[model samples]
Target: MGTVKVLVDDLLYYNKKDWNAKVGKAKKDNVLTVVSKIKVKSAYIYELISGMYITAATKFLKFTSK
Candidate 1:
């Protein structure tokens, strides 16, 4: 899954009900949410031999999952 941060118009009333109401209105209007910024994070795993099972798993997922 991926995530993005966006900026939205300020609520006329800074209350839970008002905020939810504005959000529902925006959704119904198909308002586009602008992504102001993005941050990505990843991890690297290293294995010397990658094991038979690991290699087989990769192959199966790559070739047969479609």
Candidate 2:
């Protein structure tokens, strides 16, 4: 529908932390983790297909359960 934008903070700007801790198992997992910080200018679901799914999953986990 519209453009997708997301603001991420404290993201892995450097290659710090363990591989699992830094990137996790899936790339999507890392992306979701990063998107969690985007309170403003978050990516729009309609604009993104796959990327939004990861963010949506992150939000679901944050709101629904562990």
- Give the top-scoring candidate (lDDT): 2
Question: Each candidate: what lDDT?
Answer: 0.19, 0.27
Model 2: clashing residue pairs? none
TM-score of 1: 0.14
Which ranges of candidate 1 are over 4 A from the true structure?
Answer: 1-24, 29-33, 37-66
* TM-score for each predicted model, relative to the true structure: 0.14, 0.19
Task: List runs of model 2 lying over 4 Å from the truth.
Answer: 9-52, 56-66
Query: Candidate 2 lDDT, tens digit per residue, 1-66?
Result: 222222333222212222222332222223232322232244321212233322332332232222
**Which pairs clash in model 1?**
none
RMSD of each: 19.7, 12.8
Q: Model 2 RMSD to the real structure?
A: 12.8
Judge candidate 1 against the unseen true structure and give its global Cα lDDT, from 0 to 1.
0.19
